[model samples]
Target: MSDTSKPWNSPMPEPQFDLMRRILSAPSPVGLEGAMTYGVLKPHFESFAPAEWKLQQFMGHAGVVLDTHPGRDDLFKVMIIGHADKIRMQVRSIGDDGKIWINTDAFLPNVLIGHEVTLFSEDPGAQGSYRRIDGGTVEALGAIHFSDPAQRSGEKGIKKEQIYLDLQIHGENKKQQVENLGVRPGDSIIFNRPIRHGFSPDTFYGAYLDNGLGCFVTAEVARLIAEAGGTEQVRVLFTIASYEEIGRFGSRVMAGEMRPDAIIAVDVNHDYVAAPGIGDRRMQPLEMGKGFTMSVGAIASEQLNRIIETTARVQDIPMQRDIVGPDTGTDGMAGVLAAVDCVATSIGFPIRNMHTISETGYTKDVLAAIHAITHTVQALDALPDPHREFRDNHPRLDQAGALEHQGSEKPETADK
Candidate 1:
């Protein structure tokens, strides 16, 4: 889109997924969850990531902030924002009477009680509830209370009180700004943290990388396709899902919304470098620099697996196969259940100490995951309708259907 010489035909050197694996696998320090999240979210949020160049063609504009890191100064700062008016009903502590109290003075750490703290909520109906209070006074009898000991005891405890912000603009001038920009009170607020490329160029860390890396990969694929003049009949939806760590809620919602012909749920998998329970025997042993792992189990359809496997073989991409046994416990579950004709697959990086601050992955796995996913998508796009039909009628399906049709089928068979 920028008139740069497109390397659509020229064989671009396959990224060394091994390098990504090594970098991500490095022992991260404590309190670096933000680094992980930032790693994942940065590509989606900034134009500096390689994928931004391609996304510009499809989205018309890259949905990324250009000036992500402004100052060279370093200071450890953390800002927490309440979600909409839910802060209004903020519950600080359990009261002696077993009731929750509202603490009007319970302002966020650095901001003052009456200060305008940015509030963000995903709910559309609750976005406009911001209101400023005089020194942030809470109703003494209200369900929220402050943590200050002086305010507690008589009727309510300051520790039991919580403060809520009313973000609604009351003045006419403020109303005009809202009308022009479409900013409203339940509108979700996002705080921007300067993207800090660590002091060492070889090492960097920040927030939001959990599934952000997957989002980045998708963006890069989109860019590659756009630069190749785009594909015919296939549309890719690069989604930045919410609530993945909490409960795969974003994937569920995305699956329900798109009901795509097929789905590939990309996320991180554990790399047992330092951990004991995981090894090469039971769980597919993944090295930090090996590449991406593809899951094999009931959750992944044979057809999709074959397609992915074949593509990787042809492209000479390094990949590992993981057997998940009965279930994968991934967003792939939600994707499979969303539509009758859809198939779901998993592509994951090797992360160590998952769900912890020290969670690590190799840079190689990241690059490998990107290659694996792009190849899978291309393979799927190239398949004809008849191929899909044949897969549905394959012997494996017939045998399974026959077992179901015949009441003589056994419930379970133990491994010999």
Candidate 2:
């Protein structure tokens, strides 16, 4: 397209890399999300939310849902899916010498031996409940520097069991000091890597891009939709599904809660991460700067994919199609099983080094994804009978001839 044409199509504000960085820096490690991350992310959700949009937190789960579905007889529901959690370790025990023994649900790379980290604990500061308290620099045993350097063995292949943290205060009365301050087992520990400026200004290097970027993008989609006074035809819902890393807890908890017409999900994928099999941008299936990865799976709605593909072209956003999964290793599958027979599909964002402190994402591609989702949401309003294509091809019954879809039909949208 010519330079003049580009300006006309690009109407949205520059994607907020800052917002993505903010969430990325905050720690929302798996099951510990409510204790560490929910409060951190709540402010952002409140700030960007429009008056018509209703933001609600699910205590049973560790994430938030922003509802924009209108109160009407005929309503189309679209869920923009993303997880709001990351990988981290926990304090299993506090040694008498002021050392903290850690345990993790996820496999953290041994390369973390020499990295700095933050310890999150609870304190009832004036408030009636346990508030977040900084526990200071996490001192790992095998780190680069030790007080007596020559005494070190230059260890290799460190395991989580062998690791320990230095709480600084030690010797007699050590356990008492830590215990009195509410430093107990089960507190979360996360790497101390702040969101840093990447190779270029537009690029970002931070923790939790796997879904921090996903969460940010989901919120951005909601913000864009809400700004336009919500979609006329489809009542759009941008959901930050939590605990996706460890078998999708958020998706399961909230699944079938609302029987939407279709479900759409996105997460930073491994397709474009710096890898050998993926090479040459032109030949790559899904690479950075190539746009979003449109995954085609059995559970994914074919009609939704068609609509996304059409919207991508119209918006001049490049999209790569992947034919892989009976279960796409994403929230889409969980959503599929949960909601009787809602159409399920996903978009994969390109990023490097998932499950690391310094995951990398291209700003241009991230912004492009936001546009693609925004355009698809916009198209839902303009498209007539968007659900027909998927419905016609949808499964009618099982081998035993029982109806595939049997549940509470939509009484009305949330607003009603």
Candidate 3:
């Protein structure tokens, strides 16, 4: 029984929340994520990183790595990754009616209707320049009177091909009018809804909580580790990746390049406790305001998980166990995909309505993830020998010894 009447306030400090807001506000749609990574995260990283710390920039995408100790193979390396990209729509074609047909990438069509969006169009006249259009609204058949009976009753779902953006162009020569404004095919469109406080305390709901929250957690953890005088025995690579929404290509590339001994991928998880229509899947009841989640299955390293769990317990930080089977469905698989030969696990906070215009999260859970990861890194640094501990401490089946009978000591007759 929690207080429902309580007003919501941000759990993070003003500056931290401002940083998070900026990160979330910066559009980092799939193929074009540099705006967020290079524009926001790079500056944030540089502001607090020590003089000896190295900031590694990528040659292609906006993926970046902040290394506490560069070129130190002797030290145990740990890479903490969080992708910066958000799922977005791309311009497919322009209709003569002035409707911009779009390819809805990773979004359900029903969520796009009537919501305002920002179209980032590349300047045709200037090779690298771009223009931003902020007044467009995504639409389908427009009014309810135009919808078919099946569509009105929700029996038929909206298709991605049917989705288009309306920029309020009228009269004739609509296509020419759009082109004149530099709007063209292949432009990226993102939800213009900014993140803000929810009705509940310490809650927030808006666009792009999936991975922007992940990057925010990673960046905050990096700041914490830096302020703690840095690690002595471990070289930490704090990475903000790109293209995770597409296929985790950027994080896989980072893993291949760094080849760390272990990786902790921070990302968002579904708040299955509050998520609707997921009861048939029988997922664990993970929810917001429950601290952070740590991966328990999949390619998640058991030994590495032990370190994080122990850190959480020792630090008295609230945590939830997330069971991810076969694949983590996150950048946690970057090491495996790149054949990096490293232990890997995922850390996250549960957020409801993922991959939608109004994804929601709890700031307390985010702060918990930051603390958990920071302490885990410090715990690794304090270890006598990290490589040997992880290599030699794998769970053994023989360690359980023999099982004893719970009922009778001797065998009983078949029919007795």
Query: Best-fitting candidate, measured by lDDT?
Result: 3
Q: What are the models' TM-scores?
A: 0.51, 0.80, 0.94
lDDT tens digits, residues 1-416, model 3? 12231112226767777888889988888878888888999999999999999999988788999999999989999999999888989999998888899999889898899999999988888888878999999999889899999999989989989999999999889988988898878899999988998898888899998789889989998998998899999999999988888888999999999999999999999899998888999998999888899998999999999999998877767789999989999999999999999999999999999888889999888988988899899999999999998989999977888877678555674322
Give the alpha-carbon lDDT of every model: 0.44, 0.69, 0.89
Where does candidate 1 stray beyond 4 Å? 1-208, 277-281, 386-416
Which residue pairs clash within candidate 3? none
Off by over 4 Å in 2: 1-15, 32-50, 70-73, 124-128, 131-156, 271-273, 276-285, 393-416
Give RMSD to native, each candidate: 15.3, 9.7, 6.0
The TM-score of candidate 1 is 0.51
Q: Rate residue 380 of model 2 by lDDT.
A: 79
Arranged by lDDT, best first:
3, 2, 1
lDDT of 1 by residue, 1-416 (tens): 22133222122233423223322332121212222223433443343333322221112211222111122113111000000011112323333332223333212322223333332222344553332222222223233253444444545332323333333435456435433433333332221212223343222233223444555455555445445554333445444444444355545655565445556667767665556755555655665555677888867767777877888766666677877777665666656555434666777766654433234555546666666666666655565652344356544544553334557656674221
Candidate 2 overall lDDT versus native: 0.69
